[model samples]
Target: MEVIQVKNLSKNYGALQAVDRVSFAVPEGSVFGMLGPNGAGKTTTIECIIGLQKRSGGEVTVLGLDPAISRKELYGSIGVQLQETVYQDKAKVFELCQLFSSMYPDPLDYKLLLERFGLEAKTRTYLRNLSGGERQKVAIVLALIANPRLVVLDELTTGLDPQSRREMWAYIKELQAEGRTIFMTTHYMEEAAHLCDQVCIIDEGRIVALDTVDGVIENAGMDTMISFETQDEIGMVLEKLPGVNRVEQEHEQVRLYSQKEDVLTDLILLLREHAVEYRKINISRPGLEDAFLQLTGKEWKEKVS
Candidate 1:
């Protein structure tokens, strides 16, 4: 079942086109990721879906209801976490949850949510007293309080540290296991690669590539980077080797990057012909990061730390 459908979605601001004819469908009970760079119009596309921004052209439907006409009805079925959140400084954590829960017809257990997020200790704590990660956790709990069928999360792990981010990822998996659909946008490539069932890469307000994470990687038409240490001078035949894209040498180690998966076989043979040997070979597979660069023609390195 398709829970969300967007067709020929276009948004513009004066002479600048923010989003242009973007189209994609999110399946029910699946994690769909919208991946792109800072100015790629990702936020505009999401805002169009949630009815936060009106599009210049195109159509959007959430749960078979038009977002523009059925804005109130749609809110009950979908939860949202924006890129930034601000809480009332004087409000307690538990108090905010209660306030949000009352707005929905059927909300989840606030105490249970607090316990699940390890926020039980902070229930009575003032909103201003919580850390960044804790504040984000509270935002998530509020979004899920209505037990929405579809959740829209933007920059899901923005301010989190490595350990806390991973923990949140695991929690998202739990939501999927319970058959909840997730639609999200993020600058983090690894997060999209790790959690997305289907990915749509956008650039300059247009859709560039849409496929599964592995499919997107394969579509990049780029090869893996293979490196190893060798006492012998492998630079002698590096350019002459078949399936080699480029060659980089750093002292005793030579790194060969290629598009063909079997490039290593040919490389090993070439080494033997030259009577050169290497040790501790390492191959780095092409991932979402490479796909983003290929699709958008942008320079980006994953900031995992």
Candidate 2:
């Protein structure tokens, strides 16, 4: 069953079309990810889907009801954590949690959630006194307090430390085990690769690619990358070798991309034949970021930075 369905969804801000004819579905009991560079319409698409923003065109259904028309009805079944949330500076953690819990008929134990998130000691802490990561944790706790059937997270682990991020991942997996659908937007390719069953890549307000993790990598047709630092200028010589698709050279660094399985062996033999000394050699298979680069023609790191 699809917990969320979007068809030709478009959102505009005056003359700017933020989301352009985007379409996708979120299956029940699965994690679905929306990935794209900043200003790629990911947040706008999410807003339209959840009825937080009015879409200029297209349709969206969440839990079989139109979000724009039945937002109140859908609220009971959906929990949302936005990228940015504003809170009263003087508000206490426990007070806010209690307020949110009151909105739901049967909410989860906010006290237990505070303990689970390691915020028990800060239950009476003022919202303004908490660190960015701690505040993010509070947002997550409130999102899940409803015991919602569907959870929507925007940049879910943005402010978390490595340990907290992994802990949150485990918690999300637990939510899935309970048959809750998860729809998320994230800039982290590794996070999407690790948690999402399906991912949609959007660029410039349009859908560029959508597939399973491995499927996207395979379909991108990106070659394996080999990088090394060497004093010898062997780029021209290596480019002529069979199985070497391309070679890039910069001062003492060289990079080779190839689709051939024997490219590594070929490189070794060529280097030995010419007695070209090399160091810091490394080889890597194409991953989610590579696929993003292949389809968008933009480096993931550069995009995020």
Candidate 3:
């Protein structure tokens, strides 16, 4: 079953169209990801789906009901963690958790959530006193407090440290194991590649590609990259080899891109034929980031750290 369906969705701000006829579906019990560069309408599209922003045109349904009309009911079944969250500075951690729990008919154990997020000791601490990472974890705990069947996370690990980021990833996997649907927007391509079952790449308010991680990479026509440091100036010679698409040489370093699986063997034979000595050789396959760059012609600016 599809937990979320969006068809020809569009959102405009005066003369500018932020989301242009975007269509996609999030399957139940699967992790769906929306990816794009900054200001490419990722956030706008998400806001429209969750009823936080009104769309200019198109249809949106969340868990079988129209989000714009059934927002109150939808909120009970869906938990959302937006990219940015603000709270009363004077409020304590436990106080905010209790407040959010009151709004749901069946809330999870907030204390257990705090402990899992490593914030149990900070329950009595004021929100203003917590670190940025701690505050972000609090937002996540509140989003899950409703025991929602569908969870929407925008930039889930933006403010987290490396360890906390891994922990959150594990928790997301746990959610999926329990048969929950997850829809998320993220600038981290590796995160999408690792966690998402399906990904939609949007550029200039339009979807450029939508597929599984490997499918996107394959469809982008991206090839395996082989690079090495070679003292021999064998320029343009590797390009003549079968399966080699492109060859680049820079000072004593060479990079080759190939589409065929036998390219490595052919490359070795060619190198031996020319007696070209190479070192520090490395081979890497195209990933989500490579596909995004190929389709959008733009760099992913967000650093995972």
Which one is best on TM-score? 3
Report how far off residue 162 is in candidate 1 (Å).
Answer: 1.7
What are the runs in model 2 whose C-alpha is more than 4 Å off? 159-163, 227-256, 260-281, 302-305
C-alpha lDDT of residue 200 in model 1: 94
Reference-based lDDT, each prediction: 0.88, 0.89, 0.90
Off by over 4 Å in 1: 233-251, 269-275, 301-305
- Candidate 3: stretches off by over 4 Å: 231-237, 249-251, 270-276, 303-305
Q: In lDDT terms, which candidate is top?
A: 3
Which residue pairs in candidate 2 collide?
Answer: none
Q: How large is the C-alpha RMSD of every model relative to the true structure?
A: 2.6, 3.4, 2.4
Relative to the unseen true structure, what is the C-alpha lDDT of residue 210 in candidate 2, on a scale of 0 to 100? 92
The C-alpha TM-scores of every prediction are 0.90, 0.84, 0.91
What is the per-residue lDDT of model 2 for residues 97-148, given as tens digits with 9 covering 90 to 100? 9999999999999999999888999999999999877888898889989899
Worst 10 residues of 1 by lDDT: 296-305
TM-score rank, highest first?
3, 1, 2
lDDT (tens digit, per residue) of candidate 3 on 101-179: 9999999999999998889999999999998778878888999899998999998887577777777788889889989
